[model samples]
Target chain A: MARLSDVIEKFIKSLLEESEGELELQRNELADYFECAPSQINYVLATRFSVSHGYYIESRRGGGGYIRIVCLDVDKNNFLHYLVSEGIGSRITEHDALHIVQRLLEQNYIAPKSAGLIKSAITDKAIGIPSTLKDTIRANILKSMITAVMAWQGK
Target chain B: MARLSDVIEKFIKSLLEESEGELELQRNELADYFECAPSQINYVLATRFSVSHGYYIESRRGGGGYIRIVCLDVDKNNFLHYLVSEGIGSRITEHDALHIVQRLLEQNYIAPKSAGLIKSAITDKAIGIPSTLKDTIRANILKSMITAVMAWQGK
Candidate 1:
């Protein structure tokens, strides 16, 4: 079964596709239509429609406040640069990492095989250390790797 | 069509691939998934993934215990080295892998450029995959990258 968030994400994306990657709607109305609370819409937006996911959003609260979503036409190379330099912090959650890779894969920035290799190298078990030390290493490793590839491709 | 044992082996291997070189499972549940007797899972585990195949297995029979599988570190250059050859798999932790790269650098086998390349290429953040799939891809990249470097050196 599809998660409610997933369904909402798909529904929102469908709307964006028709509207040239931009959509404006009332959050309460969207929640009512989906038979969910307005908070649900907020949750979906926060997690799924983040900047890392190539989305930009602005929501005005109170009556007549419309939530506007702008799907950025960001290129993979530029996105990759942001990911290495600013997006990734000292320690990253598995979920965030997966999101970035998925975007890269969808945009054809990286080969599927290369994507897989990236995942294997960053597991908690693979790092085999205390939590405090893991994140620092992950950041260093990820940054260097992304930069190396960019250089290789002359990007 | 594959034999029952072959099917079992493949299924387990598939799980291992997603897991990046290790897996822990309930034998009974696995047997149920395969629609075979519990003995079938045991037999496959014993025969197909023996110590000779570069695997380590440990199992406990009581409740809440699990069958633990660790892909040993087997050095590609020195097949007997536990940290390299047997240690890397479909998934690798950041720490263990960094250790290997550090060793390579100390040994002067890989230049700083190549080591940096290796780290970036393997971060889960860089790969951006679901946890299940990250490790396998990581292993593949590391192995291919290492082999490619070795080949370059030889020529």
Candidate 2:
């Protein structure tokens, strides 16, 4: 027999997938369905799901209160499609660009060496004077190169 | 006479300048060296140096515990180049993309008009794409424009 927490976790994930937007679940009701403590739901959420793990969770206190979870999907095909439309225009910040690169790496969308090369290329201070525009330019170049790679991968 | 606090501050700054990586120290030992209250060290760290001010401080209480401080040298230029080579291979957000442009403007690298043009081009309203590809294209275009600008600047 499967553990109650595992069952609850799967059940909640399924609900989140089925829902179009945010997923809201009542702790008590979920506990009743699983015949476990209300805190068990909390345990499953805290352990199996976290923001760092690509999940957003919110909860309210008091009667009829519920927990809301948002899933951050990083599917490779979907990411590629998304990249194609958001044409890199001119400027992008270092932090924001870094986040995108990190996300792609985490999702295995790009190889480690490729990611390192990208990081080093943009960081080469010899490219331009240190300024905000440099970050933007770096972001644009990264987006363009990555999109080209993705397009190539589709072949 | 130079105050003990002044002496300590100078000592720490010199240590930072000479040291590689983070600097570690003990509050009680430092207090004994200066012949002051342990809280005095805390006061100096809290007031003069902070992580937000480009310094990182970490400490622990109890036996044989110590404090560690790291000066963060955020190389905006290097980070930008790294983004170009690594980050642009995919999609990015308009907000993040704008941040890079803004940073470039602050650094006096790109003209303000160019930044504005790039921003308007990459926005969701501009792209009109429900998919995430908008971010990727936005990153790519930004990179190309920057590279062109850098090449021009070099000439």
- lDDT (Cα atoms) of all candidates against the true structure: 0.68, 0.63
Q: What is the C-alpha RMSD of each candidate to the true structure, in Å?
A: 10.8, 14.8
- Name the top TM-score candidate: 1
- Would you estimate the TM-scores of all the predictions? 0.53, 0.34
lDDT (10s digit) by residue, model 2, range A1-155? 24567678788878876895369888899888888888988898986677644678998989878898988776677675665456344555655565566656766776554454344334424223344456555655566556545654544
Q: How much is the lDDT of residue A12 in candidate 2?
A: 81
| Predictions' DockQ, in order | 0.14, 0.03
CAPRI tier of model 2: incorrect
Lowest lDDT block of 10, candidate 2 chain A: A120-129
